[model samples]
Target chain A: MTDTWLTSLITDTPQQGYELAITLSRRGVKYTQPDMDTLKKLRPEYANSAEGLTAASHVIAVNFQTVAAANNYWRG
Target chain B: MTDTWLTSLITDTPQQGYELAITLSRRGVKYTQPDMDTLKKLRPEYANSAEGLTAASHVIAVNFQTVAAANNYWRG
Candidate 1:
């Protein structure tokens, strides 16, 4: 389900996508906001997977580092 | 995964969470953007379910109607 959301965020449309990418760096999860252009260039495996997409619609679609950051950000 | 992101978006530490609520209204899927205050008062069962959240981190939590709108918006 999560993957579906991320993939949709990237694959559903090819125009200017709205993404939040904070992972590129630590642990847990990150809040990634990848733009449409960047989204187009990203590999499916790297960004969102088929199973993941099948699972849900909306997803964070980022590395754990960003997830943790976002969590911390919200907490703070 | 999708739900996790959204729940995090809401429950983790919601100050002013970012949500896209398109579901409450049509088909396919909707894009929703519900605010934090509202989120604080919403019932989790209705907003972000445990399974839904477990599925993904960034799911577009909305009624099917909003999903179609967002999809159309992105497609067009």
Candidate 2:
């Protein structure tokens, strides 16, 4: 439903964000770790604060979804 | 799981950010609008950048889940 939106949202993150990848794999989900190039463009504010990582966390191409989960999930 | 993380993530936003509320309902999801107090503490970097509103879009307590989805969902 949100093809264009998804395209813009899709991005990568630093290895530091890979912790999210490890967490997701444990929960039975499919995802890829974003490369450094993409992570550089990412706004650090959205990255995970819980793990004390300066780089942006996981990133992907999401279709139509509510912001509720993301809203809370991004917080530290 | 992540009870401490969930508590920290839950927050609020200005009425302008309520647009996310409408999106979630359209998608058959349940969510709440955060009070201004909660939104204030929210780091602006995590707030919805796509929308003109500077306020945080949405906030809720989330259990252990894949960060991949939230990683993409939070952008814009």
Among all candidates shown, the one with the greatest TM-score: 1
DockQ of each: 0.06, 0.05
Candidate 2 Cα errors over 4 Å, as ranges: A1-58, A61-76, B1-22, B25-33, B48-76
Q: What fraction of correct interface contacts does each candidate retain?
A: 0.06, 0.06
Query: lDDT of candidate 2?
Result: 0.27
Per-residue error (Å), model 2, residue A59: 3.7
In model 2, how large is the Cα lDDT of residue B69? 46
Which DockQ-derived CAPRI band holds candidate 2? incorrect
Candidate 2 local Cα displacement, residue A75, angstroms? 39
Q: What's the C-alpha lDDT at position A31 in model 1?
A: 32
Task: Give the per-residue Cα lDDT of candidate 1 at B49.
Answer: 64
Candidate 2: residue A5 Cα off by (Å): 7.8
State each candidate's clash count.
55, 1
lDDT of 1 by residue, B1-72 (tens): 133223222222121222333221110111222333433443353346666444323333322223233233
